[model samples]
Target: MKRRQTNTNFFDLTNLSGDIRGGAISFLVAVPLCLGIALASGAPLFAGIIAGLVGGLVVGLFSRSALSISGPEAGLIVVTLSAIETLGSFPAFLLATCIAGLMQIGLGFARAGMVSNFFPSSVIKGMLAGIGIILIIKQLPHLVGYDADAAEGLALFQPGGFNIIEQLRMSLGQFSGVAMLIALSSLAVFYLWGRLLFQQRAFVKNVPAALIVVLLGIFINELVRMVFPQLALRGNHLVQLPVPGSPQEFLQLFTMPDFSQWNNPLVYTSAVAIALVASLEALLSVEATDELDPLKRKTPANHELKAQGIGNIVSGLIGGIPLTSVIVRSSVSINAGARTRLAALVHGTLLLICVVTLPTLLNKIPWASLAAILLVTGYKLARIEVFKGVFAEGPAKFIPFAVTIIAILLTDLLTGIGIGMITGIVFILREHYQNTHRVRTEHANNITRIHVSLGDHVSFLSKAKLLKLLKNIPDNAVVEIDGTGSSYIDSDVIKAIENFGVAACQRNIQLVFLPARPAESPVYTLTELADNYRRNNSERGFRHDSQPHLHRQVNPTPI
Candidate 1:
């Protein structure tokens, strides 16, 4: 028998080319977002990059999730900013972040990460779609060369109460033709590669289209600078990476956490908040990334939590922001053909190497080109087919999926997920109400015969429906309530059944209630037992209140 390849090995060289290509493209995409998130969090620009480094290197090394990329999460920006302000210093906040990591480690050991299993599949898909929509909308300004609101693009609302749509409208009027050219040109190249090159050419497919687009963007912009200097993209229009001139200046980038503030209660409070938020984000990302994996492999959630905890600890130690698995970067890596964790390691390594050695080279790439890459990725994530597939699964799935997308657009991620979760739970309860029991009625002469077959493992959720069902039985009817099929029936349901016997006597209905089988009962089919009970009861004849005598004779299971 052949041994199955369950997961890709850490040092697997079979996919080195693809991992490198994916990693390099991911590195390109991550740089600006890292800077943008750090700017939003009121941290040093380099801090986000450092978090990305620890997330990718440390978390990736230990995480069981093959494609999940961890880094400075945009969702934590408000939390970090508030913590920093409340703590009176960034270093103090860093100490809190380190404490948060310890808490996350505790949660992992306690297996709290399994809480992610309760999230409905529809909600997870909706989250991906919501993030996709956000990406497309937020990147629009960059695609058009509008750079004023760069740091806050990921936020749903700006400081002036302007939404993303308003920002888009404002940016359109002041758009740069040069930036538009680059973005449009890059998108066109992506379209061509997807439509023609990927399926037909093997060698060329190995080289990521994103890399080609970046190189083309550089060549075009440089050419424009030489020939028509006025039309060339410049300054803020391109990536702005802060370069360190000396070894001493590079050392200044790393900030140590302030350990003296251990006595402050605020630090502990901040730690709890960060721990909860970061762990939730990481678990959600793990779930979403697993859904996107072509191999359909599942990530061990607790392992992922531990990995994220370690990443955050190292990040805080080095003056970096709190880190979590980010779905956007993970999706980008998946789309770029990453097959192993090595891609994550490579991306982190590139973040360190490029910032130190090729910051000038990175500065040449236009934001428009990067935006084009994200736009394509966003389209893929929220494709029409995904919506169609969910819709085909019926309203039970689609409603939550659609609601989650809309909620995320209207509010933030966690709030939207909570709403979606509640919506999913409502549907679940509705299903339980309708499906807990099956009722069939037949007419014979002037009387009615009704059979109520309880479902396996009936719970308290079905209590109301069961009572309503019992109340609706007409007078002068013969009722048989069978629970022989149930492995475990709730006490609430049993009480309802017991109470219905009293109502049956008043209504002049004959009731025969069969409780669930006992654990030590002999091996006998439920159908056989139900048939034997009906035969015996009919032969001896039953009164309107024969339930007590019937139970004494048969000595049936007590529930």
Candidate 2:
């Protein structure tokens, strides 16, 4: 098969129209997502916009993925929230984000992009599911117009002794009918927009559901203001963007990281966590985008990592959140016929332009509308089908998956992933132990014969089971252990078989060993093997862990 060409040139304006159109559509989709994720992260609202710009301009320039879009990701909301909260200051958290960027660059140089492959799919799914559940719980407050803790970190239980249930109860007491009305209406728009897509209408397909939600929100609030001034949403109830009258003021909006936090150990810890999660999310998104690419282009994972690292560095220095290659925006771009990195670059340029020129228009967007977008996103991540699919994969997959979710909800992201990794390893070892060999026993002409066939690979994990199987053999029985199918057999297994031969001598059993190489197959009477074991022990001071230097028997040797 011929290799596909990765020949997309940056200056190739052949697909300029397509790229521009795709970028515009993705920009509409990204607006609410960036705002919502920033809100969720408890960071300054403009931080998300900064990350979006860096993701598109910087990462898009450096990454080999032509269609993938990079921006502040929903997956990192929990991480960002915890990091900011733990550091006690957004500037300090910016320090961590910078460190994370450097770490990602180091990872790229070390060629560690493949590290994500070590993560089990089940655990990743569970992590997303856990984040989804938390997203819903956190957004509930905003959806109900309780914006007191809008800038707080997301935890099932907060430092203020308020749990998810308690927060919901409190939000209920402070619920605004106007906020709920807008949120529900936004959801309704999303549903209707989805239905419109099914009709294959060109105009409907072009319009983003999020853009509709934002417009609806603005219109509804405006209507309320004119008709019932008492119920209009304002202040914290709306999106708050810092409108700058000049370029100097716009530059002032970018906050620099507090370099003094370099000595903080917690900063390094958060950095590591952010780098790992961002890299994994990027790798997953890149892989997904490759599959979606019409040209079937393969992204160079290391380059992508390096690009993300640089993007994060820029974002961090400018008071933005960590970024990842977001699949949602990428898919939207692809569906909109994006053909090159130009599409992403265009999106970033548009975001910069919009924020600088239309901060007031953006501010008119209600938090309730953004919350509604996130609610839909969170629902998609932890939908019933996701759970059902995992459950269908059986306990081997579902157990660790469920455990990761519970652990993340109760403890935190890093802790939950660690626990899930250990659990996945345990299940793997259990499977290896139980399936190392296939065993069969037969009785014919008043004689018992047992056969054991080793699997393709036998490790120390199978030693105990192998011993038990040998021990269960009755006296005067003939046993044959075949290792021909095994490409690699552990030394521990060989030692067990040798010891069993010594023990079989006293029981008057016959042992036949079939080594992985058929030419090395041997038949030996238990007595001969026992004599060799004793002789070898005397001559070489052989211990149990020592190699079993069993020689090939000359002929059919009798006891």
Candidate 3:
């Protein structure tokens, strides 16, 4: 709950050299992701760049999270796509983004950022794994140089990832052998590059493997064009970063939101969905990134919401897609030795400069290579290690995790989370019911003993099981409902006990309920029930020991 207390001024340029190096490293990684996510999100390629810029320049300055990077995310692909489809226009979707931004600001103010804390970690992992699986599947066509629905995006579900079998069928029939070769080669390089240099050389590890992969794709494509002209890929097979030769031409890329659609209910609906999902995704990323932080710095979730809110507002106002704190980019920043948020700011600025000045060079980067990079990214997300880890937690944990993944694949992000949450709640309730109390039955001589011990803080949720226990007491048995350890008991449970105590007479069961210490513990009234039964069955023979019990009901066969 403590503020991100620091003695140094936030903007102090104390480590200019380190900031520059770290920022440059982060920038190298951000370029491809910005383009890839943009392609996936069905937004103008420039939108991704702008989001990156605002994320760094605006959110980076405001965020207390020192290592997190923010931008358009693959996780929001379905949500963004659905919003655009429902709104019927990209410009209208931008308006929804603005609304989402304002909503995020409200969430920050209302302290609603803690909502992510309630989501079981397994569910969160499943969400990302689902997204990862979809990412790999969606990018398959792109990797093979078959962009049947190039403009639709790269996600397997929608916006960025949709059309699994249909697209694959078409892509296979009309596939580019040359593009597939490049993708395969690049993938191999990624595998070898990480294994070779990641742990071996500090400089090699710091420089992103994506840079090498992209360069190799470009070189290989150029070689194909020169040698095997018939097998070459052109147009959308390569990244289409518009070469705006002049400043005026660059300005033409920006699109404004349609304020006229403000009254449309769909706009508000889109905003609400974006606000909720984006907030959740950002907070989850923060959680993951903080764990990766070697210094173990914790980012205040509310502050993160505020930073993202401001970033999204700025991004939407400037014709950018909605953005969130993204793990891929943030982890890259951390791995690159970034000590402050300045690295993130530098990456955004670099994106702006590159898009404006190096459009031609940027355009040369092949989509297949980016697809290779993202494929690897997807693999990391849904790695075998993750599956093993989840499984090791046991079925009680793994079922919800596995179910969440399946649900997200079959449905949208929100629906999948809902299903996973329901599954998780079931296990939680089962655990609660089992641990709510202890029950034991014993028989000595001709008398039977049914003992029930309540756990601390027994609430209404424990009522049903307790009642069932009470009902199963044998005829002419001694029943002791112990509540001495329970600090609180629901009124419903108290009422149930009262009703059961009355029914005890007809059943001829001896009910001994231990009253808790209180002016009026629910168990306090159990003594009264014992009194009534004692007065009514005074003529009956019973046995008692020297416990001076709170409640001891005695009954032979009922009169």
Across 1-559, the per-residue lDDT of candidate 2 in tens digits comes to 2222343455346777667767876776576667767988889878988999899888888887888999998669878999999999999999999899999999999999876566777887877787678767778888888765544233476355337777788889988989999999999887886784554887665566666787898999999999999999999788666788899988877999999999999999999999999988898678656756788777778878999999999999998999999866776676656888889999998888888888788778888887776677667668899999999999989999999888878866557777887888788888787788877667778888676777877677888988888888898887877665766666677778787776676787877655353223243322333356556643332222122223333232111
Q: 1-559 in candidate 1: lDDT tens per residue?
A: 1112434356457778877877788888888888878988899999988998888889889887888888998889878988998999999999999999999999999999889999999999999998898888888888888865545334465355338778788789878888888899999889888875465988567789898899988988999999999989988778888899998999999999999999999999999999999999999988999899887777888878888889888999999999999988888888998878888999999998888889899999998898888898889889999999999999999999999998888878888898999999999988877788887776768888777778886788988888888788888898887776777677677667656665666677787656445534443433334455456544333332222223212322221
Clashes of 2: 0
Candidate 1, TM-score vs. the true structure? 0.90
Off by over 4 Å in 2: 1-48, 64-69, 72-99, 149-155, 158-162, 196-200, 255-301, 317-321, 324-347, 517-559
- Runs in model 3 with CA error above 4 Å? 1-45, 74-96, 148-161, 196-198, 228-230, 255-270, 288-298, 327-343, 442-446, 515-559
Measured by lDDT, the strongest candidate is 1
Sort by TM-score, best first: what order? 1, 3, 2
lDDT of each: 0.82, 0.77, 0.75
* Span of ten consecutive residues with least summed lDDT in model 3: 550-559
lDDT of 1: 0.82
TM-scores of the candidates in the order shown = 0.90, 0.77, 0.80
